[model samples]
Target: MRSNRDRAILALAVSTAARASELLGLRGADLDWGDQLAQVRRKGSGAQQWLPASAESFVWLRLYLEDLGPLGPDAPVWWTLRRRERSGDVLERRPLTYDALRAVLRRANTALGTNWTMHDLRHTSALRMVRSQRLSLRDVQVVLGHAHLTTTQIYLVEDDQEILRRVHQYLADQAEPSQEAVASESTVGYDSNDLAVLLGGVPR
Candidate 1:
């Protein structure tokens, strides 16, 4: 079974498409419970952006936070578990680092026999949003915090099968007559050669 912390991490990664650094930099105060959104600082741009958490993510995140007990607004949303200095047997908390986050994902993937990096989760999120057809490219660009629409276009690569299906459908629609009356009515005694000519070609 997956731990609550793991679930929360995966959910946020796939839901927000946030960078590893942004995820690691998240603070308790950045989360807006009322809006179900988290504010993050984008890399390079250094601009603040807001990402909405899915309902499932919110549930897991809540569970993980509850396990942390009371924390100040400045405390890290995700913390590392460390051994206590005095008890040695007891575990203490510290800020989560990129390496620590990577280790957590690696451990989770070991049982599943998969090799996925943190950035892959971002790409997965982008593809899912595009395939869903619910949001426009502009909307996806905004959600992903991409500065250029061209960059967002790169994320919308379609499957070959899907492309073929759409092309076939478009051709079929274009070839279809507006009314049945527009079609030729002299098919009573048409030969194979004549049918081939009408259809442009015969199947080999």
Candidate 2:
């Protein structure tokens, strides 16, 4: 059960794809616990995100802090359950650090056979936006805090699976046509000359 806590943390980190610094910078108070949305500051660009917390994370955090009672507004969000030191001696109260987070992720990868790095989590987040959510590049740029849309563009992956999915959808839609359905849809009719106007020349 305790091991699952560690696994859950690892899952959340990769799925969120937030920088270690940004993830560590999160505060408990930033969460709307009931709604599972959190306000986070991206590390380099300083952009803020309204990230949706995973249901598991929300539940775990609530249970972990239940005995500690309510936290202050500026309290450190992630706790080490120990003090920082040259040696890994435990401290009672201290904020979780990036170094510690790195160690946690390393263990998680070893256990799961998932060759993931800290930044790969961020990449995973970007991939999730593309695959699962089908978010626009513009939306990804805002969420990932890329300084330029070009930076975000590098992560756009159009894999064979996506091509197949699109092709299947196209074929399915083509196979299921009805005149009544077409009639109910709005039409933007174009003259044959529209193509020439668009191309700025006659078709070769």
Worst 10 residues of 1 by lDDT: 179-188
* lDDT of every predicted structure (CA atoms): 0.84, 0.72
Q: 1-204 in candidate 2: lDDT tens per residue?
A: 244435445555665666778777777677787787767797866777877668877666666666456778788667757755765775576677878777776776787888777788778778878666667888778777777999988887888987999999999988998787787674556555777788797853
lDDT by residue for model 1 (1-204), tens: 267877888888899888889877888898888888988889888788889878888889899888878767988888868888889999878888888888887886897899999999999999988888688999889988888999999987888998899999999978876555355555446788877888999743
Q: Model 1 Cα displacement at 55 (Å)? A: 0.7
What alpha-carbon RMSD in Å does predicted model 1 have with respect to the real structure? 9.3
In model 2, what are the clashing residue pairs, if there are any?
17-121, 17-122, 82-91, 83-91
| Models, CA RMSD each | 9.3, 10.7
Evaluated with TM-score, which candidate comes out highest? 1
TM-score, one value per model: 0.76, 0.69
Candidate 1: residue pairs that collide: none
